[model samples]
Target: NDKLKFTIRGSYINNLTSKNSRVNLNTGVTWFAGKGWTVNFLNTSSFHRVTNNTGSSSFTSSYFELGINKSFDIQQPRHKYYNYTAVFYKDLNGNRIHDANEPGVSDVLAEIIRANPEQDLKDKNYNGEFLSNELYSNDKGKIEYDNIVEGVYNIKYIPKDIQNAHYESEGTEKQFVAKKDTVMYIPFMERNKLFGKISLHRTQHSALGDIPLGNIKITVEGNDKTYSALTDKEGYFEMYIPVSDYYKVKINNIFREHFTLRQESYIIKFNGYKRFELSFDFDEKARKIHFDESDFLITDEEENGNVSFEDIKVIKQTNLRGIVKDANSLLPIHAIVSIFNNKTGELISETASSRRTGVYFTSFFAGDSYTIKVKAQGYWTYTEDLYLNQITTFDNVNRDILLRKTYIDEEIKTENLRFKSGNSELSALAKAELDNLVSTLFLNPDIIIEIGGHTDDMEALSVNAKQLSEMRAKAVADYMKQRGLSEKRMKIRALSNHDPKSRLDTPEGRAQNRRVSIIIAGF
Candidate 1:
């Protein structure tokens, strides 16, 4: 109950009255047993709030009282049954036994669940995870479930802090019963698990040596979810992913407009190991992709959980097109056009020209120089170096290669051999081209051959031009001799500037003039 009063004097500052409110609830129960045994239970609650002009205050209180009367003739039912006990001991050897230094594990929460035999198998908790009817264990590291109604029962234990504790059931659910009292010895497993780290490096084969690729974005897709990670500056990455044997891996550099590899979809298999160390390998379909090394080492700390992918750069690819035509007829010819990195000579992509139109399509990144190698069945090989600058609004490159027929004494121009700048040292591509020449000479062993090296008129000094031309031709002959050919079977001729392939009028014509040719000499 509360009362309030107010008085007005001047305009606004007179007097203000205070008010209070009170609420209460009470309930009682009397459980009576025959002959005088009775128990009385009382519950009461009250709340009061007082308010002035400034603020208010509230107080709440509750009371419960239970009374029992003792003298009574009522008898308690007694059940004759033994107690079910649980004894927990540490198996230092993980064999579920309490050996010499091993002692009983104390204060572990071991709950008990009991269900009737005829109950439907669908009798599950709201989460449909566990069965109903549970009991907790005592602090003595022992659980005693007594007078267990003649039904099936199961004991379950889960680790509290997995860092220090862990457990596993011995496949005995729904089978343990208490027709008579029984004691159960549950097994526990230590939480120590085999952990490891992974290192990612991308190795590339180049004319100089092997190169490592970095800033690669990788994803390991599992059954439930996918894990993303980025390699470091040294092309290293590690993560703590769930156990999975087969993971769908998708790796690319699409964000920076770099099409390093056209094939990114891989069904990778992670072999089972307590501490697994491994790397990835891409087959014929993996072009311009580097597989440096996948290294593995074991550790107890799980640090891969915090691995982030903030630094890896991805890129998009642009569409590139061209056609292949014959030099004499200028007509379309079916040929294979392959792209490689101009700087590293790493093969990137390969496509064939259509049979009817000789049209071809491919994908490449912008702002990079690429070398295209075209090969047809009856024609000599051709290679061209080109540069594409547009990245935003990319335009198709219409490079039509003119391939010459390969016949006896025709001196058809093939891919120019790559040599070390200002030196006669042959590059990988140069060696590959010489291999084809050696095969041709071996097939026609009954005949002799002459290799001629030519130069454009660009070299100002005639002596320097003649020297470079002769050195290049001698390099080719030396390679053929190493391939089991006699020195007498091959002859080298240095023909500089005099017999240019075309007029040294433009850069393209000059490029055609700087070459080496294989001539068929008499037997």
Candidate 2:
């Protein structure tokens, strides 16, 4: 092609007529890179030698040359070129960190303006017109501008040009020195508003209309943060939230004392909407009494059903209360009832059931997880997990506990409670038996028992039978106590080799003797 060319030239000279010799060599290549541009490389070598009486000495030297040449007209002005790219993304979190879930916003119009007016005028004079100053972002939220003159510039955007009106840029504009290729990352945050209303149904199964639940508190929990708002007298509330896939909306526990909701919480998902409206209904716990329309001011009016208030029984009082009874006899019993925080195990409330009526009373704050423990002298500790979301419900306030008595001197098959040879660790079979034993001990809080360890008669097979026996017994006692049985109720005894359940003449007999036995000591 005429646009490019390559060439090489060389010259060599040598003289051999005299004792002293001289040589010269020259090589070079020239390339036509592009329009009015050329690249060249040239090398030269020289050699000289002199003959003397003692020895001959020679001198050699080489020269290399490399350069780029361009032909230009003096009338044309020199201009340096630069490239720029801009990327836009939604800033879900205001932290300025680009998270994986945040997506790009496309088709946004951006304007490039030179910061220096002199440079701007020069660019316009040289380029004729700056038509590439304004462009829209591509589908990938990127805008690429090439062949821009080297200068300081600013990239600006119009708020209305963005895809959503609720979005606002993180910065007023981007300022960069376009000395080389550069990229700008711009982030925008979404300001979404949600409006909500909370109402209460006056009567069950009837729409005498709904009354606005004033002063009710609502909370939105997500992103490891929480936002709260209160309803006005008209049951209207508004809150602004960050962009997220899901947020849990729940009524504050303070408002739960007077109302109950069938669905305790709601999930809100932002789907690129500027505004949202939501409504929730709650069952009011207010007492119903006989009253005429003239007796009080009613806020709502609807004709869903009509019933006589005289037939409705008014509840005088209500409490967080329950009854304790025997599981088998179904008779009222006296026991200690306690509530503990399920997470921290801290005691929150403690009370005793009446000896005569078997009724216990205690109160708790709503929206907390707790462990309800009921214990008696000879009954297994009864435990139930409770989450008090709404305190005004009938079942929420009424919790009954049934106590089952512990097993007394129950025969546990001893053959299944043997340990491995030369090991004090309880086997799976032994652990299973000990679990049953622990349950008995848990309910029989007043009972004291002894754990006895025995071994077969094998003096040559064992180094220290008594020590191994003691360890086996202690292992069983330790396991039971760890499972909620009191350590004070257990006593360990090592009865090695002297009391074997079977003859040690056989391996099966030895296995039977290597066992731990539970003995009832006192109650």
Candidate 3:
């Protein structure tokens, strides 16, 4: 009602000499919009009459007018309001981009400090350090402060106040000029990188022979939480974790079954803000040691902040080195080299001859007799026995090998080449007989042969007879494959009890029937 205006007016005049009378009427309406704007309309009407001269004549005229009006009221301006917004969010994927699926963090308290004032006028109560109040983020993770004066300011948050230990802020403080509404984004990432290496301690006697265990899983557990990392090609694993009182670090259980850890799990007390490095190894004679906190801790006495594992004494490796070549052509041969301890009858180490260089090397303890076997495709396997006495130095012992080439088809059958009852694994006698055949197959690469598997009729049911025969043939084929023979050069046949090398009436004949025979099919 205050924005609208209305007016009405009337006037009357009388002439005494001419006896004439006049009348006028006017009406107007005005509407006021905000900020000095108005719309107005007016109407006017007039009537006149002469009584003596014109004997009563009357006329009336009316007109309407419409208009819009604006008024500028110049007054002293009030303080303009500006806003500062801080957006707090977690960087879930570590890409640094705030995705729509990622949720915003709430209740984050941020403080604002004015770096510069709009005017040089400094009040005695004004301090440069902080504002009067702290801003808190709402459920949408937006910390907003309004009615801020135009000035340069800083927004900051304390790391300890975040409450989430696993996350570290990307930016601790942000400086901006709040001439208008301003928005700043703060992201947090996983904190505390833990890195270490995994190795295999071959033996206490061979300190320089440790092998890096690559592509293995290492896990870290602390405060009812677990984190894991996969070793790279260099057997190094790294992960980020939260600050905890203590942590238990260990390798995969599959590795534990194969090799023994001196300490199954390592426990370390850790604090925040520092990265740590450690190493571990699996050994055959690694006895279960008591958990010594000092053994896996970084003390102030240490110059570097690295957690040290047991220091392995360095020792020189007694290596065996050689080259394998064709006996006739004198050409290099890529071969599989293996060493076995003569006294213990155990394999010491295995290596391969370089395809281009035909060079191979392996390490072992001295003062023991060892047998070296070199096998290659298209060449006969070479075997030799040598003794490294106590006088042998740490220097490599060089012994070259020459393999014979074969061009003829040869089949050697032995009754001792038999599998154990109800099993497909090759026994010592079977392996010894097959080793000779492996060389022949390797020496002559063009020879394709049929491996005939057979079983005795001792089983009451022949249900597993064919399967067992097939497995036995596969076992022989797999062995040759390991010894550097191609599968394409060999064919398998499961003959079962149908084919026999000897009569089945006697026990000795049955033993002979359970043998596998290798027959050359073609060149």
CA lDDT of 455 in candidate 1? 72
User: CA lDDT, every prediction?
Assistant: 0.59, 0.71, 0.72
Q: Pick the candidate with the highest TM-score.
A: 2
- The alpha-carbon RMSD values of the candidates against the true structure, listed in the order shown, are 29.8, 21.7, 24.8
Candidate 1 achieves a global lDDT of 0.59
Rank by TM-score (best first): 2, 3, 1
TM-score of each: 0.26, 0.31, 0.28
Full-model lDDT, candidate 2: 0.71
lDDT of 2 at 496: 83
Off by over 4 Å in 2: 1-323, 327-330, 361-363, 387-394, 397-400, 406-417, 427-447, 456-468, 477-489, 495-513
| Model 3: CA > 4 A from native | 1-189, 196-218, 222-237, 242-246, 251-264, 268-338, 342-363, 367-369, 372-391, 396-435, 438-523
Residue by residue across 1-523, what tens digits does model 2's lDDT show?
5644445444444455557776777777778777678888888888878777788889998999998999862332556667788878778765666677777777678898877667566654555333437887777778899877766788887553644456666456788887788987788767678788876655553312222345567888876777888787687898776676778888743334456776778888777776777877777565445777755443344223343466454332224567899999989888998888878878977877766567776655443577788888777678888755653433236788898765656434455678777778888887887787676566556778878887777732655888888998999888887888877888889988777888748888888888888766767
Candidates 2 and 3 compared by TM-score, better number: 2
Candidate that beats the other on TM-score, 1 or 2, i.e. the better one: 2
lDDT of 1 by residue, 358-442 (tens): 7666666553678788878767677676666655543545676788765656553458563333356666887887787776555
Residue pairs of candidate 2 with colliding backbone atoms: none
Model 1 misplaced regions, further than 4 Å: 1-82, 97-101, 117-140, 162-175, 204-523
**Structure candidate 3, residue pairs in collision:** 379-443
Candidate with more favorable, higher TM-score: 1 or 3 = 3
